[model samples]
Target: MFDIEYLILIFRDEFNYFMMKKVVKLLPLQHRNKDCVAIQFDFNDSIKAAVMKVGAKWSKTHTCFYILNETKLKQRLFLSLKKLNCFVDYSAMPKVDQVKKSVNKEASLPKSHAHALQVFEDYLIGQRKSPSTVHTYRNFLNLFLNYYAKRDLASIDLRSIEIFLEQVMAKRGYSVSSHRQCISALKHFSELNLGMKYDPANLYMPRKDKKLPVVLSSTEIVLILRSTKNLKHRAILGLLYSSGLRIGELLKLKLGDVDLERNTIYVKQSKGRKDRNCSLGQRIRPMLLNYAQTYQPKVFLFEGEEEGKPYNATSIRQFLKRSCQAAGIQKHVTPHTLRHSYATHLLENGVDVRYIQELLGHSRPETTMIYTHVTERKIDEITNPLDSAIQKFNRMDNETPNPLLSRNENK
Candidate 1:
């Protein structure tokens, strides 16, 4: 029954061997390394011998040594000095985390009924609407909603839309075409989202001006064709006159749609997505064949610079503009002018109105009848008031004045 005093030792570094007098404790030699005590201590040989007498096991892991005692054990636990690196200190970190947090907060803030917009977009895509059309419609609705953030869908009445259209016209100076586009987008959105038909009566859409289609004279058409330096331009203008093709129809022509043997061009999925066959004259067939051979376009009849890409309508329109300016023509000529000229020339040549209608792919013959109003011979054939008065004057000059009126007026 003896108590032994022991010293606690802690090593700073294994190689340096710096020992420090950490603590001291007392314990019975017989109780060293005993299982009765739950906690144990470890130290060097001198410290181990003192703790082992008290039934405590030595641990190589700890950097400190412990002394066993009757009530408590004294130990100095050596901890490695942690060197502060880039990540350990908050101030040393980049500003990216703060920016990211701010971004996340703003992004998570809902985009004015995001769920509703997503539903509308999905419905539009499901209906096989064109991607551009879908984007336009979706953006229109988003602008409307974001502009009037306070108003709910139920609160957005016909009157609200009407007022918005007016504001758009007055403030944005949108033309009839643009106004119609806005109305169209909203109408589709309302149909899909609110499950209600948008009545045109509810909206005060601007009246689209009824401008007569510009028709090129046959002489002007010839001049425009002759001004073209490239085979492509010549062939395009020729086809425009030959097939009565709108620029859109011309650009959409695939390689296989042209029939060289029959001298015909197939207009696939035209304006109203209707397909029609148009005659290709034997005259322009050689030009077309030459253009085909020269360009060697793989897919589209008129391949653009981007490999197999089809000729864009806008580019073709610009080409026509440049060609018209070069030709020194005073008339405002468009690709559509060639189409109008084709119809007007046909009508003047005594082609049946119904036949012209069929050739131009007009749904109704009445639409094609406008050419009749503009035909030169049709206008000249009508009896003029001047001609009637001239005949009466001629008869009087040759024979006598009106006897009763002339005699009475003299008296």
Candidate 2:
């Protein structure tokens, strides 16, 4: 009897250990138009409850529990699950380091192409192109070079470039914007390296799809701002809306850029590499002061976990989504939406379009004019033609009086 009881106990212990070691996979999924990490595992009540505690939600469409796929949130979920003795398999998820390594590995070029690419890169850097622009142009040039690796670089003409672009579009499903960038990249390369002077009129570029910017109403904006309880988060969203700073520009802000006395924020080398000053809201002054004291940022206005590093934009986006959800907002809101709302609100308040242009740092007036179409100020003032015509007909009918009604009254 003692031997049989001991064997049963050992078997139960082994079974429990195996159950605790069950694997749960975290998958990349697009849920409700937002990137989310889906937690997939064999159904277990305990694991489900634990995942819920870590803020994972069930998606009917995807048939899995998911959480916002931010770095910090992923780390939190991993740690939380580990504490519950759940094995997490996150190998399927993409990592920034892995992506960088993959890109580096794929960057091989032939000897001739490598020399030309180097020369082109040096030229771009010498011309003071932004890092992103240089990287894009180099990648496009590399693709073109690799396609015609056997042919002489100087021998390539506009016709060959067109064929390459057509093939790429068909294969990769390139959008109009990407197609335009590829053209621009090739044009620059042809002019600089191949000594080709192609006429701009000859290049047939596709028209860009016109889509209006989404603007949140003042009440909704207020709700979103009020819902954000964290001072740092509130300040970030507040600055984005109040000053109309682009996400990149906001992330690049340093303590020295803000001038409390002048009530202005110096935006240095923004889009188009232009520097501009934006008005600082008096309301946000106290908040900024309090945040500065609380956070005690060493370098950038908003630093990440490590000192002197600019705060991760992904973190800002993650918190903004949470704030919008807490505010009961259903719209797809992004950081740029705040900037759009800022411009539209300014336009509705009778601010000159030219002044709005300067504030937004737009190179052309037409770019600022887009806000005019979206502003509700003029739209609200004008009555609909159908409504006006209906009202007039009703008044005329009442005054004329129906003949049948008159006859009936006589009877």
Candidate 3:
């Protein structure tokens, strides 16, 4: 197979060896006082049986599973984690998997707003806000607090907050998105945290213009794949294009979510906390298998250098940018561009728009209908009226041989 043709192979594998395999979502956190390892895992019979086999118990306090973290059960616990691909690689003696033993603790907050930030974080967790939201909202709040470090929380009102937003917009020259995010954070802090109402004017932000997503051609996508040399990077590009995954969804992928045997990827806990199955490209199957065997990613299909964490969305963006440059695709493409292209190309291939909606995990058909406007397939099918008229006139002249024109030509 030539370079780009490598992406066109079809694979058939009926047996699901990964069916029983479990993904350890959050690798067990060792709670010394609790004397248990708090493990977050996808629910499966095999996993439950493993927990029972270890005499492990569930902890409501931590909202996770607890295996007795004693020397007696340590080996058994590590073995149980094998299904998650998180066991220590005994081949490397000097180090072990941090997921099995280490905790990913957040950095300490500044002293000025530590207590208030803690309250906000606790509130977000209690409300079951997604991790990304918690991080973003917390950062925004931190900036707000940092702007007026000495201002008393109770004394500060909407007027003071509006000034801070003005500064953010004017001095920082940030977009409306940031300005709106700041307003949202302040609102959350005031209403939810401080139990105070903010003025409506302080919270108001102008609506942003809706921009259509960029879609790449299939040939351009192939060129990008051909340009990417690393196996993992290629697999990432292939999966992004083939599955039409959002960057967040791609990052959240667990080893268990990929079922090569079924040629499907289960997208769990997406935008609306909904799980959906997406098609796995048969051509990319071999690439995935190779990455799985070589990288041995634990907890996620693709992981960061950090032991337990999934691949960072920002880094993947950088990879795409570089791949685009190398492929000489001038269009400003992001990860979502591939997704838009996927939907558009599927539409071109005569796939029903409604089915495309499900594939993209859009709840509303209207949201999916936007592709119809941009799809060149429909536009390409349309013939120009002038061209048709010219063709008809030419045919008539050729067949009937207009006498005046024929006489002039003979003269």
The C-alpha stretches of model 1 lying farther than 4 A from their native spots are 1-110, 127-136, 193-201, 400-411
Q: Would you list the clashing residue pairs of candidate 3?
A: none
lDDT of 1 at 212: 72
TM-score of candidate 3 against the unseen true structure: 0.61
Q: Residue 4's C-alpha lDDT in candidate 2?
A: 88
Q: Write down the TM-score of every candidate.
A: 0.65, 0.79, 0.61
Q: How accurate is candidate 3 locally (lDDT)?
A: 0.74
TM-score of 2: 0.79
What is each predicted model's overall lDDT from 0 to 1? 0.66, 0.84, 0.74
Q: For residues 210-301, write the lDDT of model 3, one tens digit per residue.
A: 77778898899999999998898999989999999998899989988989889999999898788999999989999999988989887989
Looking at candidate 2, what is the lDDT of residue 410? 47
Model 3 lDDT at residue 16: 39
lDDT by residue (189-223, candidate 1, tens digit) is 76654533356556665677776778887888888
* TM-score for candidate 1: 0.65
What's the residue-level lDDT of 196 in candidate 2?
Answer: 43
Best by TM-score: 2
- Model 2: CA > 4 A from native: 1-23, 26-77, 90-101, 144-164, 194-203, 402-411
